[model samples]
Structure formats: C-alpha cells, structure tokens
Target: NKLRVGLLFGGRSGEHEVSISSARAIAQAISSDQNAQKYELLPFYIQKDGYWLAGEIAQQVLTSGTPLQLNGSNIQLPNPSQTSLPIPTSPYLPVSSSSSSAQVADVDVWFPIIHGPNGEDGTVQGLLQLMQIPYVGSGVLGSAMGMDKIAMKMAFAQAGLPQVKYMTINRAQVWSNPCVFPKLCDQIEATLGYPCFVKPANLGSSVGIAKVRSRSELETALDNAASYDRRLIIEAGVVARELECAVLGNDNPKASVVGEITFESDFYDYETKYTAGKAGFLIPAPVPESVSSAIQEMSLQAFASVDAAGLARVDFFYVEATGEVLINEINTLPGFTATSMYPQMWEKSGVPFTELVDQLIQLALERHS
Candidate 1:
C-alpha cells in the first residue's frame, strides 16, 4: 500500500545545484515525516551529463553537504517495455563491486525537483507523459508556456490579462545578423522603450537575468541571457510591487496567503534572490482585503488558464501609483526547499510542509487512477 516515490533531481540544466538542494529537502523531509512508511523517497540523480547514479551513493549525494565530484561518465535511458527511462545503474551502489549491473525499484510517482530549461520547460514532462506516470505540477502545454515568458505573456494577452510590455529575440536572429541586432533594439526602443529587464526564456532562480536602463546595457544583458537560453525576452520595466500567490490541486485549485518579496538590491536579481542574502520577505503581503481577494482570485484563474495541475505559484506586478495589477509570471514547479515561499505559504495556510508533499503524492495517484 506504500508509494515508492522517485525524487529526481540534478539534471543537465543550469539549475543543477538548485535541483540538488531541492532533492535533499524532499528526501530528508519525506524520510523524517510521521508518514514515512506511507511513501519512500528513492534517491534518483540525473547527473550533469545525464548519467544515473543510484543506491546509497545517490542517497549520500542527497544528504551530504560537500560538492560531488562525480566519477560517473554517463548513463543511458534504454527503451524498455517495463520501465520509463531506462533505470540508471551505477557501479558504486551495486550489490557487489564485482557486479556492474543493477535494477532499480519501480517508481510509483516522480517528483522532479528541477527548476529550469530542459528540466522544467516541458521536455521532461513530455517524457513522463509518454511513460504514463502521474507526476506533480503542470502538463506539457502548461509547463512549456510557463517556462517561456514570451508564450506566457501571449497567453495573458489572449486571456485579456495585463502584463508588462516585452518582446522575444532568438539567438539565431541575433547572431545570424549582427547588423540587425541594433535594428531590433531600435524597434524595441520605439515600441516598449527603456529600462527593460533581459531574461533568458527558460531559466529559473533569476539566473542569467539583468536589469537594463539603456541601449548599451541591453546588449550586455542580452548576451548574458543568451548564454543561458537560445530565446531571450526583454521586458519594459515597470515600477510595481512584487507579489506572489501559491495555487494547489488539479482541476479547481485554491490559493494560499499572499506574500511579498522585498529585495535589498535594485530589483530581485540573481544576487538578491539566491545569494547576497540581503533580500527579506513579508508574509501575508501588506495589501487591502479587497486587493488580497482579487489577487487570490486572479492567481487561481491564471493557474487554470495554463491548465496547471498539482501546484504553481503565480507572480504579479502591482503598481501602487496606478492601482494596476498585472500578471508577471507563473512557476509551474517552484522552488521546493522546505523554507521556500511556496511551502511556507501553505504551512501558514494550515497545511504543514510534510502534509503538502503527502497531498501532492495523493493527488498524483488520485488523478492517475
């Protein structure tokens, strides 16, 4: 009757470390929870080169504080009638050092703690869908839409929702015609104007994101962003409050208490977010009751619009001067560290962290069955 959950993390994406951190949280939290026997947190590592490291060594990686200088060269996903991606086998965790073969336990559920690019951009979700396994968060369409700011904004526009002015530029276009880059900038200047935020189309944790104030800054920002993703999006900066709400469930979802992220820097950039440790956050965002209700309502609607299931945290840009609230983005699978805002919001809303993860597993089975 127990569920064997594969907590998959540490993929080839730029957020590899973030994924590792998240996996540690899931493994520890699930293992220590009172309902531990109800589910098993199987350590599954997708190495930078896509090799599978299993058994106790994988578990050590999940629990250890030191950086892993993995000796693993690579792991292949074999096409098998019985398994999803071929079960990754490694020499370190084998029953005997003399044997190189290993067969991993069957996984009843998959918790992909990945945060960016190939991991969160629907590529992994498509594979999971093909494997006919019920995983958490959004489906392929929703995951893809949420990963790219361009497509997400397009969805907002189609839904008649307000979002900051922005445009997308492919790396191929930028490199294909260096002369055209300026022309493209000129067009953006004429259309959306200055003080833009350059963001990689499919990265998370504020990696490869820059706040640009002028044309000169835009070039450097775009180059930095292009290093992370082939598609780059530039948003005309707006002076708005950073507000976030957590959405849960599959069909009709519920929103958690609103939260505000106050950055000690100019904006919530990479340093302010994951490092620098200068930024502070406020629980139950300081907003009027009416505004809170409106935000929560809109957050649920946005989650539904994307066809998101399980969980998603919808972010919004609310400008106080204009009393305007615009949808900024939706994170289909947000940061899952136990201390992260998503888990915190639910915890404050009466669902404890372990209960939250347990509920997600139950939801996956409920939906799949």
Candidate 2:
C-alpha cells in the first residue's frame, strides 16, 4: 500500500512564498519518482488565512499569479477515539458542536515544508502533538528554541559551545527605554565594534537583516529588523568566510562535506539568497582537510545541542586569517528547493534529490515506529 504523505506548505509567515517554492519542488520531485509508487505525496497548503486545503484548487492557487482567493476552510485533526471534552455550555439547554461530521485528512505522517513563524516556531508542532500525529522534523522544544536566535544561543551556551557574541532587543524594551536599543547598539559598537550583523531573532533566509559598518546605521537597521520580529539580534561581526554542513537522521546523524557560500553583498541577504541569478554556491568548499573535519565535528555538536531530529543545515563563520571557527546559525529546516545547499551538499556527496527525499521519508518512518 502507498504510504499517504501529507506535504504541508504555505503559512502565515514571511516565508509564505518561500514555502510555496519548497512545496513546488517537492511536488515535482515526488510525483516524478518511480520508486515512490508505494509512498504518495499529498500537498496540504496552509493559506495566508490559515486555511488548509488539498486537491486541484490548492495547486491552481499555488501556481497562478492571481491574488489568493481562499475558497478553503480550516483543517483540524480528527480524534479517532471520538472522545468529547467538557466545554462551557448554555446555562439553560446545553448545545454541542457537531464535530463528528468534521472532515479529516488521511495522513500517515505530516511533512511541514513551511518555514519561519507559526509553522516552524513549534506552534503547529504543538497542535500536532496534542492531536497525537507523527510529523517530520524536530519536536516542540527543539523547533521553538531553534527558530529563535536568542533561545538557540542560550542552548549553545548551556552546551559549552562556542558562539559569536550577541545581544537581543525586544519591542517592549525598545519602547519603554527609548534609549535602551541605541545604548545597547552603542555598547555593541564599543565591544564588538563595527560591521556586526543585525537580524530578527526568529527569521531565516536572511530576511530583514542588515550588516552595519558604522554606528550611524545601527538605529535604522535595528528598527527595520524589529518590524519583522518582536525581538532583534545583533551578533559580533566576524570577518570570515561562510561555510555550511548538511546533517541528516535523528539518533546517529551524519554530516556531509563542507560547502561555501559566496554572496554578492556584505553578507547573505534576501535577494542574494533566493533571487534568480543571484548568489553563487560552491560544493565542497575549497578548504583544507583538517578545517573541514573540525567544521563537521562542530556541526554534529550543534545539532545534538538542540536535540534536532530529521535534518538541519548548520552554518559557520570561518576566519581564514585567524583559523577560528564560529557557529553562526543552525537551520532545522534549511531550504529544499533542489538548488538549496542542504540537498546540494548531500547530492554532491552522492545522494540525489529523489534519493534524499526517500531517505528523509525513511528517517521519518524510522522515527515514528
């Protein structure tokens, strides 16, 4: 029997379009896979309105350039036990909602292709946990903590790992102590000095991030980042090269060959990341054998620190002059758009796209059972 795989995509996050792109890649990859005959891919799209719908209507909306017209309704997990919980009833005659007629999706497992908030931040994972469904990727604490830069750094620190110096700013603090942010930025200027990276504490794909070379640009850059997330993070700028490693599996995870990203900007930004004909990537980064080994070792340590499952792409900042390696960030769900680094690294290591997905599915099944 074909295993029913629900490939969930789109979300109420800044990465909605990015999620769509990921979904499209999965659609094309899985549908064309000859070995996946017994394991089907059912795309479940979560519209901007938080509606979950499958079938042709969802596909049309995904491909069409037209504005999203959600002709869809909400999707809630079905309780096979059909157990009822106590709820506030009318003072006089009690009325109950008809949940027995509720529609349910037949999914052996859920593959969340959505990124950033709402989905990747552990919100959806929590719901899935309550509903007792097996889904792909890390669990609640890992997802939530990994998604937030502040929390992730805390975990790294707890694990006795090396982390770049960073400071966090929340909206309330910024508003309450109007000078709080500027003062902290000034402190960063004094401590970490100029050319630090500013980003939303909970964003990926380098969205709403800036590299400030001077204190003058600090205020504007922070304000821009604070708009995207309630909390903003500023990391001590390391004048180094950006390298990444791909990790797979849960218990005995494996790391792939080291790769390098060369961006056209001061750092990897939104356009340099996803825009067509944008950034350039090099497989098996032209680095020495010893440095590559160290990076792979550190990548596994970081992945273990977060208790990450399924797969993640760990990024690091390497100072060539100093031979110092600093952990930049670890993405639990790095891009899987075929061209993305995670799959690319694994591909170059002899795991093609279709086989990569197959292995992930096997990992999912292995974890579930």
Candidate 3:
C-alpha cells in the first residue's frame, strides 16, 4: 500500500504565501511518476483567520495557486504574540472530514511546510506530538529553539560555536519602565556599536528584521520588531559574505555544499528575499577548499547543537579579511521553494529535488521507528 502523506500548509504566519509555494513544489514532486506509486498526497490548509480547510478545499487552493477567500465575519489578523491559539474543540480532528470522520488518522505520516511564528515555532509540532503522529522536520524542542533567535544563540554559545556578538531585549521591560529604553540604547551603542541588526526573536523570512546605523534608528527598529515578537535580538553587524549549508538526516546528519547569497540591497531583508531578480546566489561558493570544509563542519555542529532532525539549513558569516567563519542561525523547516537555498544547495550537492524529498520522508519514518 502507498504511504499516505499528509501535507500541511497555509499557516497563520507572515510567511503564509511562502509556505503555500513550498507545499505546491513538494506536492508536484511527490505526485510525479517517480514517486507517484510510492506515496498518496493529502493536503491540509490553515486559513489566515485560523480556520482549518481540509480535503477538496485544500486541493483546490493548491491547484489554483491562491489563498481561499472566506467571509469577513470575525476575521482578524493573528497577533504575533498570540499566534498559538487553542486548537478547536471539535469531535473530529481539526482537519475537516471527508466520507469518514477520522481524516487525520488515515495518514501514515505528516509533512508540515508552514514557516515562521506559530507553525515553525513548535505549535504545530506540539499538536502532532499530542496526536502521536510522525512528522517531518524538527521536534518540539528543536523547532522552539530554532524559531527563537535568543534561545538559538544561547544554544550556540553553549555549544561553543563562534558567532557575532548579540544582546537580547524584552518588550515588557521597555514598556513597563520608561528609564529602561535609554539604558538599552546606551548599552547597545556601547557594546554592539553604531551598525547593528535588530530582529524579532521568534519570526523568520526576514519579516521583522531591520538594519540600524544609529541610536535613533535603533529605537525605531526596536518598536517595529516588538510588534512581531516580545523577544528581540540585536547583533553586531559584520562586513562578511552570507553563506548557507543544508543539513539532512537524524542520528548522523550530513551537510551539503556551501552556498553564498549576494544581493544588491543594503541587507537581505523581506523584499530581497522573496522578490525575484533582487538577489543572486553562488552555489559551491567561490571559496577555498579549507573554508568550505570548515563551514560544512560548523553547519553539522549547529544542527546537532539544536537537536535538529530530518533537515535544517545553517547560515553563516564568513569574514574575508580575517578568514573567520561565524555561525549565524539555523532554520529547522527551511524553505523548500524552487529558488530556496536549502533545496538548491542539495541539488548542487548531487541530490535532485525528488530524491531529496524521498530521503527526507524516509528519514522521518526512520526516526519514528
């Protein structure tokens, strides 16, 4: 019998469209003749208003390549802090039923492609954990740490991985005490200096990230990022190349070839990331063999440090002047879009897209067993 694979996407995240694109790509690959006989695809979509749409509705959205429009009643955009709303108390699973009532129980395995906030930050993984179902990517601990920049950096520090100097900011502290804001500014200017990057600790896809060159910009950046997540991160900016490596497997993970991201923007922000023709990439980055080997090693180390399983993409900053490689961050459920660095790097590493997805599914099954 074909393995029934449940593909979940369309999450209540800022990266909702990105997640849909990823699911579309994966669905196409799995439905291809190469794997068509081996697996049965079942898609489930979570609407922006936090409603679950399963079966044909999900298949229609994927087929049309657009989000479904629902009635405007009681529709509110999800707040970043309140992303993890309680699951519906329906008798059947949150996913709508078809002919039978137990739609979720029919699946042999799950593949969650949601990115950022609620989906990637362990909420969905926790739900699946409660259901005792096998799913792709990291588990509760790994997803939670990977989504929060502060916790991820702390883990990296504990692992003794080299990274840029950074500091954390709490939204409550800044709001509760007026005097706390200036203290934060003073500390940032004294420690991280003029040019630094401010990011929301619990979001990705560069949604709530900004580059500040002065104290005034830093203040505004903090307010902007705080809207997305309560925990904020300020990192000392570096003049180095942005490199990424893809890691696969569970017990013994493997790192793919190093890839570099080059962009015309001042920084790789949301626009430059999703917008076409804004950035360029160099697969098997134009670096010495030794540098490539070191990056691969660090990538594997970062993956293991976070207890990530199935797959992850470890980003780095390689300083050309000093030849120093710094671990930046890891994405547990990295983007799988055609242009995404994760799949592209693996493709360059001799693992085609179909083979890559197959290996990930096998690894998920392996870990479950």
Candidate 4:
C-alpha cells in the first residue's frame, strides 16, 4: 500500500492566508506529479475559527478557489491509539450509515504546512506527538524556540553565532507602569539606537513587525507589536544584503545555494514576502565564493544549534563594507508559496520542487523510523 500522508494547513494565525496559499501550492504540485501513485495525499484544514476539517468539505474548501470559509463540521484532536483522524462530534448534520458519515483520514505521516502561532509555535506539533504521528519540520522544543525570537536569539548566542544587537521588552511592564515606558525608551536608545526593528517575539511572516527611526515611532511600534504577543524584541538595524539558504534533513542537514532578496519597501514585510512582483530575488546571490561558503557553514551551524529537523531556512545579513555575515533568524516552517525563497533556493541548487517534496516526506518517515 502507498504511504498515506496527511497535509495539514489553514491555521488560526495572522499568517492564515499565507498558509492557505502554501496548501494550495502543495496540493497542485502533488496532484500534477507522475509518481503521485507512490503515496496517497490526505488534506486536513484547520479553519480560522478553530474547526478541524477533512473529507469532502475539506476537498471543496481547498479547491473552491474562493476565500477560506468556515464551512466544515466540528472535529477534535485524535488520540494515539485511535489510528484515525479526529472523530466529528456534531450531531445536527444528517448522517447515512455509509453515504453521510464523516470520512476518516488515517495516515502513516503528517505534513504540517501551517505557519505562525497555535500552528507553528509547536501546539499542533505537541498534539500530534501525543497522537504518536510522525510530522514534518521541527519538534516541540525546536518549534517553540524558533517561534519566539527572544529564545531563538538566546540559542544562537549560546552557539557563538554573530547576530545583530537586540533587546527584549515585556508588554506587562509597559502596561503596568506608564512611567516605565520612557525608561524603556531610554534603554532602547542606549542599546539599539534609532532605525531599529520592533517585532512580536512569537509571530512570523513579518506580522507585527515595525521599523522605527525615532522615539515616537518606537513607542507606537512597540505598542503595535505588544498587541500581538506579550514579549517584544527590538534589534539594531543593519544596512546589509538579505541572504537566505535552505537547510534540509535531520542529523546531517545540507544548505542549498544562497539567495538574496531586494525590495523598494523599507524592509521585507508581509506584502513583499507574499505578493508577486513586490520583491526581487538574486539566485546564487552575487557574492564571492568565500561569502557563500560562510553563509552555508553558518546555516548548517544554526540548524544544528536549534536541533532543527526535516527542513528550515536560515537567513543572514551580509555586510559588504565589513564583510561580516550575521545570522538573522531561522524559519522552521518557511513559506512554500510561489514567491518563497526556501524552495526557490533549493530548486536553483538542482533539487526540483517535486523531488524536494519527495525527499522531505522520506526524511519525515526516516526520522520516525
């Protein structure tokens, strides 16, 4: 029998739409493959309002080509011994013994493509762990650590990785004592200075991220980011090229060819990242071989530092004037959208999309074994 693979996406995150786009891409890719007969694809979508969907409803929601609507029946998380997808709990819907009962999607492995909070921060991974199902990407610890910028930075520092100067801010402190806000500002100016980036420590896809060049902007940015996550992070800005490399595998991960991103926006934000024609990429980033080698080396080191598995995209800031390569951040579940850098880099490095997907699935199975 073919290996059954469950594809999970459409999370309750700020990146919900991005996740849907990624899911659509993966489905299309898998459907068009000549070797698709080697495996059975089972799609599972988590609605934004916290509904677990599968069966014909999921198939319709995914293929309708319309905005994601909450149209599926209620379902819950499965138990380890269940050996099947979550059992639907609602009774209002009509059911026929065989014609109307909800379908059960049992799989040998799970491929979670959900990005951002509840999904990417390890909550879903933890649930799957309890279910004893093998899933793609990082585990609970790595996913949790990777989702929080403060914790991720600490791990990188522990590994002796060079990164931009950064500081963490607690939302509670600012909200409790209004006077403490000014002191926090002074501290930020003293440490990171102006032209810094403020971001929610736990979210990704550039959600709740701001580039502030003045005190007023800093305060507003901090407040905005605080609204998303309790822990906020501020980093000193750097005028350097944005280079990214794809790392794949578990114990012995390999880095793909380096790629660079350039855009007219103040920074690479959500729009530039997901919107086509908004940002430009330089494949085999026009840098010296030494710089490329350094990025690759650092990428592998960063992957090992976080104990990442399956796949990850390690980003770096290459300062031309100083010739310094500083680690930016590692995305455990980097976007697989058409405009994403992770798969693009790997494709340029000679790994086609279909082959990359096959390798990742095999890696997931290998890790479980």
* TM-score of each candidate structure, all chains considered together: 0.88, 0.86, 0.93, 0.90
From the highest lDDT down, the ranking of the candidates is 3, 4, 1, 2
- In the range 1-369, model 4's lDDT, one tens digit per residue, is 877777788877878777877777777666655548877777776777765665555555567633354442342323312222334742111122333213233667888898988888888888778768788888898888888899999999999999999999888855757888888999999999989999989988898899999999998998889898899999999999899999999999999999999999989998888788999999999999999999999999888888889999999999999999999998899898755788899999998877788788888888878
Q: Candidate 3 vs candidate 4: which has greater TM-score?
A: 3
Candidate 3 has a TM-score of 0.93
Model 3 residue 162 distance off true place after TM-score fit, in angstroms: 0.6
Candidate 1, position 325, lDDT: 88
Worst 10 residues of 4 by lDDT: 90-99
Which ranges of candidate 3 are over 4 A from the true structure? 72-97, 100-102
Rank the models by TM-score, top first.
3, 4, 1, 2
Q: How well is each residue in 101-158 modelled by candidate 2, as lDDT tens digits?
A: 2112456777787888887888877766775767778878878888999988888888
Could you tell me the TM-score of candidate 4? 0.90
Global lDDT of each candidate: 0.76, 0.76, 0.85, 0.81
lDDT score, candidate 3, position 363:
91
Q: Which residue runs of candidate 1 sit more than 4 Å off their true CA positions?
A: 72-105, 176-178
RMSD of each: 4.6, 5.9, 4.6, 4.5
| Per-residue accuracy of model 3 over 1-369 as CA lDDT, tens digit each | 999888989887888888889999999888988988999998877888766666666777788777766562333323312222235552114433335222576778899999997788888999888888889989999999999899899999998999999989888755657778888789989999969999988988788899999878998898888888888899999999999999999989999999999998998888999899898989989998899999999888888888889999999999999999999999999989877899999999999898888888889888888
Whichever of 2 and 3 has more lDDT, that candidate is 3
Candidate 1: RMSD to truth: 4.6
Candidates 2 and 3: which is better by TM-score?
3
